[model samples]
Target: MKTLTVFTPTYNRAYCLEKCYHSLVRQDNEDFIWLIIDDGSTDNTKELVNQWKQEKKIDIKYHWQENQGMHGAHNTAYKLIETELNVCIDSDDYMADGAVERILSYWKKYGNENVSGIAALDATIEHQIIGSKFPEKLNRATLFDLYNKYGVTGDKKLVYRTELTKLYPYPIFQDEKYVGLAYKYYMLDKQYEMLLMNEVLCHVEYLPDGSSLNMYNQYLKNPKGFSFYRKELMKLPFGGKVFKYKQAIHYVSSNLLMKNPKLFIETPKKALTVLAFPLGFLLYVFIIKKTRTEVN
Candidate 1:
């Protein structure tokens, strides 16, 4: 069995997915399996992955299923992953050179049950670190604190233990996709702090089609999913008052979008939710207007 599984959840991104494949082929360490979750793509994704599988240069496992959105694809990936460790390298992203070797080596030296897994830097293709490197001399911190406390900004790559990743599956709401993937990470944060590595493990590209680029649209389309995530975040034990209030604001907005009358009743932080109502309603209006403008 491989030590790590490098899984990619892709929709109809076969055009640019080849960059990820070639990067994997160039890996200095081959102890990772590439699992592709084809989330109901209409394009030639199946054909492209099939061709790569036949080449036999690296281990590839491909699974196809109806469109259930990104979280649904993630649910399937967790179920099928057999490795001890796993990292999601998005279809539009690729590993930095020797990233696998670096991850495996660093983990071997400092990893243990005390940590959930490693949290490493992500860089642009031009090799600029997405944000400040992990706090100097800080070895471990929950994902939430890394931002709220340490002031670390921008996206980072996460490598998690398979057992932990399987624990909190994102809820699948009918007709809605796009639950914030951070929901599970924050849940894990309640129990474990991650080993912080400053090395850039992955290079990311934010295409127009990528979810990050169109979040207001996602916010409108996935109200139920976002509502569920916000409610859960409000319940997290670690987040501070302001953080919880921010989640409450989003929670209120999502419920308002759903037209769920019991917004206050459904909230985990009722007081915060009440306090956040004005801002949340304003945010709700802003989202509606913003998305509507984009559409028109």
Candidate 2:
């Protein structure tokens, strides 16, 4: 049995999925399985994966489903993964040479029930580390505190215990497909802190069509999901008042985007929601204006 399942949630990314496959096949170690969760791609992704399945260079498991956005695919991935540990590598991204070996070695040295799993590093194809190294002299830190409290920057690789990842599953929103993936991570933060690994585990390439570049469109189109994520953030036990209010502001904006009539009444924290009104309304207006600008 493999120690880790490296899953990629993809939708219509056939053109670049091969890079990920090539990278995985080249891994120095074979202690991990690659799980590809195809999120309703209309392209030739299935055929490509099927072809790779025959190669037998590494373990490849393909599961396809309707276009349920990234969170839905993540949900499916978690449901299917049976490994002790797992990490997500995007369809457009690939792991570094020997990255699997590094992760395995690090976990073998330090991983235990007290910690979730390794929180590793990410680098670009050009070999640039995405963020600062984990806080010096830190043995463990929750995902939220690493960014919010210690001021760690950039996206990092997250390898989690399969059991822990299964506990805080992401919720599916109707008619919307975009939810902040961190909703589950934050929930996990409430329970466990992650072990920081300084080695780069994955290489990232941000495509033009990626979610990072089109967040405004995501906000406009997926207000319900965003609102749901924000509401959940407001309820986290460890985050401070300012952070909760920030979430409240986004929650307000998402509700406004959906034009929900009972926004005030539905808020979990009315005072924060009330205080965030001006900024939230402004954000709603900005999103509308931004969309109009793009259209014109």
Candidate 3:
């Protein structure tokens, strides 16, 4: 088996997906398999990937399913991955040169059952770290603490053990499609600390259609998923009070978007939820107004 499964969850992103394919093909060491989870694209994605498969430059596996959003595609990716380790490279993103080789070397030196996998850095297309690199002195940290406490910022490249990753698949909500992907990472954080590697693994591009750029619309259309994600964040004990309160604020906003009557009852911290009401209500009103003018 390949050392890693580099998975991409794609939805109508065939235009930019080639960069990902090219980068994978250029890997200095082919210690990885490319897994593409096609989330119901009404485009030429299937044909394009078929052409790549015929080339046979490297191992490629493709699965197509109805659109259930990024988190749902992730659910499918985790289920299908058979390698001991896996990492998600967004459909619009690609790995840095030698990234696969570095990851394989790192795992060989540091991987063990006690830890889940490596948390590597992500760089922008211009080749700059997305945020501060992991602390030079630290060798490992839980994914929760990396953001919640240790001041690591921005999204990082996360490689996980397939066994543990399969255990915390992101929950799929009925008729909803925007759960924060971090839900699974935090759940795993409770069980294992991630090895911190300071090498850049993936180079990211924030395409116009990507979720990060379309969050306002996501907030308006997928309030239940957002609300569920916030509730889960509030329940995690490692998060700071301020962090939980921030989640509560968003939770309240999402609840209000859904016109949920039991917002306070559903919130993990009632007092904070109460305090966040005015702001949350304001955000809810803002999202409504914003959605009205946007065609998407």
Candidate 4:
């Protein structure tokens, strides 16, 4: 059986896909399979992947499907992966040298039914850590602890057991959503803990065109998505003080600030900063406009 399955979900990213493929080709470990979920790209992405497959540089599996956004592609990848461990490498991002070998080694040493997955360091340009640090020793980490205490940020550098991952489907959204099915792993903190590998596994490039970079601006414009996210977050088994704190912040910034500015005028937080930081509501509108122009 394949020990690891690395998949990339991409759309119109043919230009950057080769970088990811090269990273995998250079891996010290070859005990993995590569799967590409092409989300209906008009670009010659299929041809590019085919060339690599024909060369036999790596075992490759390709699936092309109708465009249904990132969540849709992830759902397909989760269903089709047959390896013991699965990790997602974005089309625009690539792994550090020997990252796959290290992951497989850690899995062989520590991975078990009690462990839900593994987390690693994600770095950005100039070698700055963009996301949470992997703890040196394994410990029970709650989703709240993962976010609030450790400051879990980006989505790269996560590997999960194939069986546990297939249980949750990505949530459907009417608008652009911030968190995808990835939150399901956090929800599993109710039952299991993730192993931490203290190494930089992947480098995440922040493009002006990436989905997450502009999401805050969208959140400012359509606070309804924030309401939707909070509602879904409340449904998790770990819903409590920490969740409420984060949800309240999300609600106040998204719904109360933009959707109902009048409420802020009627009743404000006791702390002035709380009321001030969404930028007095008017400034947020200006910021959103500025971001739209810049990102677009």
The window of 10 residues in a row where model 3 has the poorest summed lDDT is 168-177
Per lDDT, the best of the predicted structures is 1
lDDT by residue (145-263, candidate 4, tens digit) is 57656666655477888898887676655554334454666567767877877688887897776777776665654465455555456456665655554554554555553556554
lDDT of 3 by residue, 236-271 (tens): 877778888889889999999898999988888899
Query: lDDT order of candidates, best first?
Result: 1, 2, 3, 4
Model 2 alpha-carbon drift over 4 Å, by segment: none
Error of 4 at 46 (Å): 1.1
TM-score to native of every candidate shown: 0.99, 0.98, 0.96, 0.80
Candidate 1: give the clashing pairs: none
- Native RMSD of candidate 3 (Å): 1.4
Instruction: Score residue 283 of candidate 2 by CA lDDT.
Output: 95
Name the top TM-score candidate: 1
Residue-level lDDT of model 2, residues 1-296, one tens digit each, is: 88989999999999999999999989989999999999999999999999988978889999999989999999999999999999999999998999888988889999999888878899999999997888778878999999999999999999999998888777788888888999989888887899998889999999999998889999999999999899999988978999998999999999999999999999999999999999999999999999888878
Model 4 poorest 10 in a row by lDDT: 264-273
Order the candidates by TM-score, highest first: 1, 2, 3, 4
Candidate 4, residue 198: the lDDT equals 69
lDDT (10s digit) by residue, model 1, range 1-296: 89999999999999999999999999989999999999999999999999999999999999999999999999999999999899999999999999999989998999898889999999999999998888788999999999999999999999999999999999999999889899999999999999999899999999999999999999999999999999999888887899999999999889989999999888888888999999999999999999999999
How well does candidate 1 score on lDDT at residue 288? 98
